[model samples]
Target: MIHGILNLPRNIWLIGLISLCNDSASEMLYPVIPLYLSSVLMAGPRALGIIEGIAEATASLLKLFSGVIMDRTRTAKPWIILGYSLAGFGRPLIALAGSWGWLLLIRFADRVGKGLRTSPRDALLASCAAPNQRGLAFGLHRAMDNAGAVIGPLLAFALLSREVPLAHIFLWAIVPALICLALSLKIRESAPAASAPKRVAFDWRLGDMPLVFKRYLVVVALFTLGNSSNMFLLLRAKEVGMPSEYVPLLWAAVSAVAMIFSIPLSALSDRVGRITVLVCGYTAYAIFYFGISATEKNTGALFLLFGLYGLFMGATEGVEKALVVDLVAEDRRGTAFGWFNLTTGLFLLPASVLFGFLYQGISPTCAFLFSGCCAIAAALLLIFFVANRRP
Candidate 1:
């Protein structure tokens, strides 16, 4: 089994394996962190918000620098390895947290690792894929990542069922981290071209990214302004009377569906147009949010809506990375991805905070309606400004 996986295309298989292990480690701890904070550590909503805010803030701040560093050094692999290793090791630190302060510190460390890794890893993935197959490559990576999402929670569930402590689950998660570390060593770095400069300045000017990519980035930021954390979505579902016991199952279902659809949808974008498939994805999100808003107490409908939500995620996540690669020059790929993530991550804080307020003040339905409207508006923008203009 190991040999078969190793014998597959090096880039694809390596990325997939790394994602599998990393996400397994992440998902094992992520779902329970808030609960642990509130229940065990006696933290409140404010603390939870602060933890998440700081974690994401750390990621946003590092991304631009990390990208510039990767491009200047013309080396992505070392950054990638370091970032994942930090994140992998950081998970166990959460298990040792005796207070919310300690948890926040650990979360910051983990996201800092994420910040360091993402842009460089994306650059490496782009380098590995054929131009035309970029969408499929990213999609496969996401699928494998979500596959770990599926497994991780299930592992958590089993461990919890066996009366295992949450801390132990986190500690045991290090096993996957070790696996990811081992796999990271196997991925040979893509050789840089002779034409590529040996050393570019670490200072990336705003002018370096093209006008089209900038415009697209604006639209993505607009869309992300309404796209908050999935934690809020779970909170909203529970607020509307969905039991806690069934929540993981809903998440698991979404991951399962996304895992199933990601590769095929990504491959479809390779044959069709990336933008076209992406617009469809945005439209699906709009419809899904609309369904969530309109349905008050229908559990059946909620499950169906969540399933479709998975499909939307499957279609867009990888394709978006492929589209970034399409829009930017090879040398500036790291910067492009960094800018993309930075913009989106910046918006998420306001979006999530606002959504929480909306859910608190008006209604959860209003929050869903707000999300749906933004998604549709984003879809329209993509149709007019992006998809139609692309060949």
Candidate 2:
């Protein structure tokens, strides 16, 4: 499996490296931002919910359009490059922030870069690999991404352990972001193949998409409605008696588990089936969320459940994209990915808000139960209604 994955492609490997750098930088800030909001700025869960919801929704709107742009342009590298550049510069600006509003502004710019880059990047990844190897290619990319997530928090932990100011640590994220930008420019872009047929008019009409893709989108949107911002999980760890400084390690633990399991599970998907692996991943998510809902101050249980949550992410994240590619025509992949991301993001805002309110106004158990139930429903729906086709 390792040898096969290593044989993917030069562009795939480079893309993974770029993802590593980008995610490394992003995770450095991600686990810290909530803490910065609550502890430093003295904000509340609702504030966190609003900030994440708005930031994600802003990115979703851009994702809705960026796919069309990429399809029209028939090139991804330029958009990918531009997106990374914005995020690279934008993330560091949080260091100067004195209020949650400033953090919100910084998040807006950063996620806009994400919204711009994601679909095009997925398009490029699809274009570079053979159809048979899409699972491996995406899996490797996600593994590298999660590996970076692991390293980023460890780096943050190191810096914080030395008594570095939290805001100052935000500035360090720029270094990896710059590295990601520099490496992204090295990706070689090719014009569309002459043998390829001309594409239809690029638009957001859902009727234009294939039935399989549309059905898959429904399942995806359902699942995403429960996939609230991970900040809630971090906050849960804190609420369960984990100390503030140790939060990054908890995040790293999750990422490390994700990094470790991504390749094996993705490769398994290639052999068994995409939907099978997807269902398993969703089941794992449901179980983990349920466990989180029920557990108390048992640090051992929290750690174990968090690691399983990582396994859920590893199994689903990249493989789901590979499945998306399989369900659509090659020419429409960018648009398909765009819609996938757009709808997912669209639901995330409300998801985050609902989870936040549950956590604050009710309890963490209520929040986790809601998410777990949603995951189960999405999984059952996919098995029964969406995954009937072989592709």
lDDT of 1 by residue, 1-391 (tens): 2343233458677878899889888876766675577668997555665577667867876887788778877777777788889999888988889999999899888988889988888888888777867877888889999998888777776776676776787798778888988888887876767787554454444676777788788789889877866766555565567665556666777788899888888878888878888888988988988887777666787789889989998999998889999988888898888898888878776777677667666877888789888888888888788765553
lDDT of each: 0.79, 0.88
**Top lDDT: which candidate number?**
2
What TM-score, computed on C-alpha atoms, does each candidate reach? 0.91, 0.97
Per-residue lDDT for 1-391 in model 2, tens only? Answer: 7777878888889989998998888998888988889889899888888899889988988876788778777899888898888998889898898999988898999999999999999988998888778888899999999999999888888887888988899888778877988899899888776776676876556877888888888898899889999998988888888877788989999999999888888878888888999999999999999999988888888889999999999999989999988888887888888899998999999999988998899988888999999999999988998877545
- Runs in model 2 deviating more than 4 A are none
TM-score of 2: 0.97
Native-referenced Cα lDDT, model 2: 0.88
Return the lDDT, model 2, position 234. Answer: 89
